[model samples]
Target: MSSPPIITSSSFSSSNPFSSLPEDVIRAHIFPRLDGCSLASVGCVTPELHSLSSDHQLWSHICHSKWPSTTTSTLTHLISSFKGGSRSFFSLSTLPPNHNIPSPSPSLSALPDQIISAVDIFYRGKCIFSKVQATETVSGWFKCSPFRIDLVGPKEAVPTPISRPSHEDTCQNLYADLELSWIVVDPTGHKAVNVSSLLPVSVERHWLSGEVHILYATVVCGHVTCSVEVTCVGGGPGGLVLHVTEACLKMEDIDGAHLNGRDSLVVLQRVLEGKRGNLCSENRKMGKVEEGRKKYLEFLERRKERREKILRREGRLDNLCVMIGSFLFVGLFYLLCFY
Candidate 1:
């Protein structure tokens, strides 16, 4: 009688459990279970998975899941133009922003006439508000005037089921409840980037109207940075009805000077082109919102230091000018007295 051959676990079942399963099963069942980062890691396991993970459909679904506003037909069409479709987009928008930007010179070559902003506001991991707004850049008004994108129109109250907190805890309440995603898509450039910190950078109460202003800021590329503000007002209990009284994004310099549309768009395009933070390792740990803000905070500190240096330089120049004028006046006075 021949000895029964031992059946090792590895021999009985292929080392790669997925190898035995049909590709369709893996694509339809397994890949969908993973996120963009996890799916990307699985792709590295074998050539087969790399192919399966590259499926545009899977990435498209992931994109739609994270950003509800990406489902819009206009934005969908724009996403399709990306080199690898939604996969390319996920890569750009998922990584922490790359603060390094090239020359701020305006370029109309690849600049789109309009941009689509896909915004989602989440509270405690559940989406409470989602909207898509289109901002037209072709207007002369846009170019000459300040660069701003208003998602919520005046007199428009976007109701949410969140309770208005007591005046004292309002700031903390808003900070704890809200996390935002603001993805900007460019059709002509075929680029997309999330220009938000995923958390409110600042929350302040208006001393006059009792309104709360929540600000989310990010460094666009170079000296130019962008910030989005969502203003929320009080609603009677159950009227816990939340309204986005104002949801506006404005781009400005470190010195608080607003950039014109052309210049703002140029810096924005540089962001789409340069994302040095894409080094998100496989099995990617998407950074914590607090950690994501490190670069932003550092940028702010850098700006502060720069401003102080400028002020010091100007002070020295002023003192030198004063001394030169005083010396000349005194010399003339002595000459007249002697004469």
Candidate 2:
């Protein structure tokens, strides 16, 4: 019988269609289609793919898409600061850092008392808006709240219901309080500026859901104040997800101010008055008593569940201690009797 020819590794290598394509073609056509997460994963497969994935152009596209408000100057500064250029900057800016490191006890004094709001607006599940704002504003009405709508600003510090003690908890809670204010961030400058401060705005409650709706104006140029409307909704599994549903911007010329001048205070006063009237009309159609009742009931249910969990854990610890004490007593009695 004649010996059969063996299929070598070289034969399989030759079959890969990607190997035949030029590096430029792969970089331009193939890499562009992959998202940031997908691109990072693909880079691990081969050295050639790794080089193409690190291209600044790919990361620049991702950064702009995620943060449309980011200016060109800010983007350039961010890229220069990071070793991996735009890729490293984008990864650090968007995602939270790894929490696995061991550390000494943190001082309570060093802990941040004021909360920062990072609002991400999504349209049909796609992120369309993102901004970071500080909660400590001159207008006490604009501060962050534990709940979606805070008609009267909170008097005392309320424990955040959504924060988890550890990552091991299977059911994760979303930080809904951070959705209250819109803060625009400059990553390169490493600063957060409140969107409301730039132009005066008012937030009104949606009749059916009690969600907040904001109407504001921003200076587009020397001539105009761009009117914008923002709406927030509770979404995702466990009703923990909070995101912006709509953000519509329309340009209107300044009325009282100079025709070719940007006067923010003047623009703010005009927008607030217009939105206030609309809020009153919407409020009349809805029943206030029903809204308050439903919100209280939901709060009680969550509080009850939390209390029951703590009691159950205490009960287990008490039983364990009792068992140990009984065994110790029995051993001492047996020794005395034997002696």
Write model 1 residue lDDT over 1-339, tens digit each, in one string: 443222223432467453577878878876787767677766666666678889999999989987788888877888898999998988888754666665454467777888888888988878878888888887899888999888888878777666665556546766767888888878777878888877787888777666778888887655667788899887655545456688888997988789999888877777777754542543342354565567668778888998999999999999999999999999999999999
- CA deviation > 4 Å runs, candidate 1: 1-13, 102-106, 236-241, 276-291, 309-339
lDDT by residue (tens digit), candidate 2, 241-275: 44455543333443322231122222322322121
Lowest summed lDDT window (length 10), candidate 1? 3-12
Error of 2 at 274 (Å): 45
Give the TM-scores of the predictions, in the order they appear. 0.82, 0.38
Candidate 2 Cα misplacement greater than 4 A, ranges? 1-14, 93-120, 125-339
Which residue pairs in candidate 1 have backbone atoms (N, alpha carbon, C) closer than 3 angstroms, thus clashing?
160-242
RMSD of 1: 6.4
Q: Flag clash pairs in model 2.
A: 132-183, 133-183
lDDT score for residue 154 of model 1: 85
Quote model 1's TM-score.
Answer: 0.82
